[model samples]
Each structure stands twice: as structure tokens, then as C-alpha cells.
Target: MVYDLNISAGELRASAGAADTLVTDLRPVLKKAVDDLTAASSSLRHWTAGPRMAETGEGWGGALGALRDNLTEHARGLRLLANGRDIMEQEVLSSFKGW
Candidate 1:
């Protein structure tokens, strides 16, 4: 059985653009939150206040930081995919351009 994904390159481009814009808008706020989390984690560690609690804070901070990084990577991938679609479409339509 052959299956078509029913995906549209134009839609991909639009979605990617929207994602990029949203991420750009949220960057500063997210960064500040991550920074605050890390700082709190560091403070907890310095005070030697309950090893488990400090560790948990550090873990949460790390996870949040990783999440931010993943979002960046996802955005990059989306743009790349969108651009790839455009390139492929251009190549496919090249023959008709002269007419």
C-alpha cells in the first residue's frame, strides 16, 4: 500500500515562519526564566540546604535549559525543511518558467 502524507510545502513554510516568530517573541522571557532557575539552583547548592532539594532544583534548571535548546534546534530544522521544500518546488517548476 502506498500512502501519501498529504503534506504541502507552502503550509510547511507558513508553519515554520509562524513558529520562528513565536519563538523570537518568547526568547527574552524564556531566557530570563531559565536564568532565574539556574540562579536559584546555584543559591540552593551554596547554602548546602538539603542535598536532595538542591539536586532537584539543579535538575529542573538543566531540563528547562535543555528544553530551550531543543526549541532552537526545532526551529532550525523547520526552517531548513521549509527551505528545502522551496528549493525542490523551484526545481520542479523550472521547465514551466520559460513558458
Candidate 2:
């Protein structure tokens, strides 16, 4: 394989930037999901749960759905980061002479 160090370096840098961007975007979403889950869990834990059962159930369901979606997004973001890291790593290894 023909390995051009200059192009590989640029690509690796770009991919690393993309990974950082993905992490930046994912963190807030994960945090919001955690916040929603915490709030829902707290409401359940502190319940006079019977009186507000229907309302609380509905709210909890919505929060859980939001959390689920956020988790999905996090998974996707993680995959992206993994792919970027893999590319960067391959570029690095390819640039080296003997490995």
C-alpha cells in the first residue's frame, strides 16, 4: 500500500476533530436524559404516588421515552467516535515504517 504521510496526517486530524465534535454534541444530550431520568425517579421516590398516579405515570413515561431516545443518540455518537478513532489509528500505523 502506498502511504502518503501528509494526507494521512490531515485526514487523521480531521477525523479527530469530528470525534471531538461528536463527543461535544453527545454529552449535552446524555446529560439532559440523565436530568430527566433523575427528575422522574425523584418524583416517583417522593410520591404521595396514589393521588397523582395517572399524571405521574404519564410524565414518567414521557421522561423514559426521552431518555431512551437520548441513549440511542449516544450510541450513534459513540459509533461515530469509534469509527473516527479507528481511521486515525490506521493512519498513524500506516505512517510508521515497521509496524
Q: Highest TM-score: give the candidate number.
A: 1
1-99 per-residue lDDT for model 1 (tens digits): 999876776777677677677767777876676567566766677566645555665676677667667777777787788788788889989968988
Q: Please give, for residues 5-39, the per-residue lDDT of candidate 2 as tens digits.
A: 44344454566566557666766775676566566
Candidate 1 Cα deviation (angstroms), residue 32: 5.9
Estimated TM-score for each candidate: 0.59, 0.42
Q: Candidate 1 regions off by >4 Å? A: 1-4, 21-49, 95-99
Residue 20 alpha-carbon offset, candidate 1, angstroms: 4.0
- Model 2 residue 64 lDDT score: 58
Give the Å shift of residue 14 in candidate 2.
25
Clashing pairs for model 2 are none
Model 1: which ten-residue window has the lowest total lDDT? 46-55
Which ten residues in a row are the worst by lDDT in model 2?
A: 4-13
List lDDT for all candidates, in order.
0.71, 0.62
